[model samples]
Target: MRARTLLTWANGTTLAGLAIARATGATIRPGRDGVLIAEGYTRRIPKNTCFTVGSVIFTRRTAEWLLADERTDLFGHESRHVGQYAALGPLFWPAYYLFCGYSYAMTGSYGCRNALEKHAGLHAGGYDPDHPLRPWAARFRRRRSENG
Candidate 1:
């Protein structure tokens, strides 16, 4: 494994991901490019069809489904997140949740304004690439524009 991959394990995020996968009854398997796929995560609350932590990508769906031809972009999107996890180490969790809160506040959607999601490619992650802001946020933007 490369240093970046090693870094994730060293930081414990990869192990945490694997633990989460096992806890949720997901089937763990190797994926292309040194990443792991954990499929069939049974939790319904988070709502995202797929999410990545360190070198592992967890999905509520099958690996085949997430890796389907048309969903190649989605896989790529999640793979980019692996790099992010490596870069951010354990800090990725707190940073990501902060982004989620910021996104929800601005757009009423968790992924819309999230910097991590934006950097990873919103369309590829099954999110609207040009999601509109919430009504209040739009009004706030308009006010700021007028003031400027």
Candidate 2:
């Protein structure tokens, strides 16, 4: 609801996401699949920053870097994700994962990827939000007929 894009990143990547969190006032922590997940994401890693399970917390290393580098836009992105996690609370993670899996299985893509990790790995190279494809994805249902 709050975030439009997600920022997803792999572990061992640069601490850009973490830096963004600290500067923007976000809580960061190690997350599944990727390292962090804010509520929303920058245009970079837009699908791994959404912290669906918990609040936006950052790792110690990353926090340090952000304090040093000083990237305003990146910081703002992670900050948005922190707010998103606060709004969604615990339900966000489970719900998001379930859907992501389904999306991946059905379409061979990660259409349900959160809106935070898009700009995650910007420091190194960057994460493609639409990179992973989920084939055989379930079709969006609007309604159903009574008897056919």
Find the candidate with the highest lDDT and give its number.
1
- lDDT measured at residue 13 in model 2 versus the true structure, 0 to 100: 20
For each candidate in the order shown, give its overall lDDT on alpha carbons. 0.88, 0.40
**Poorest 10 consecutive residues of model 2 by lDDT?**
5-14
Q: How many residue pairs clash in all the candidates, one count each?
A: 0, 58
lDDT of 2 by residue, 1-148 (tens): 2232232222212244456665655555443323244322333433433322232334333444433355444545444444444454444456556755765564455542433333333232223444544332222231223232
Model 1 spans > 4 angstroms off: none
What is the C-alpha local distance difference test score of candidate 1? 0.88
Root mean square deviation (Cα) for candidate 1: 1.6
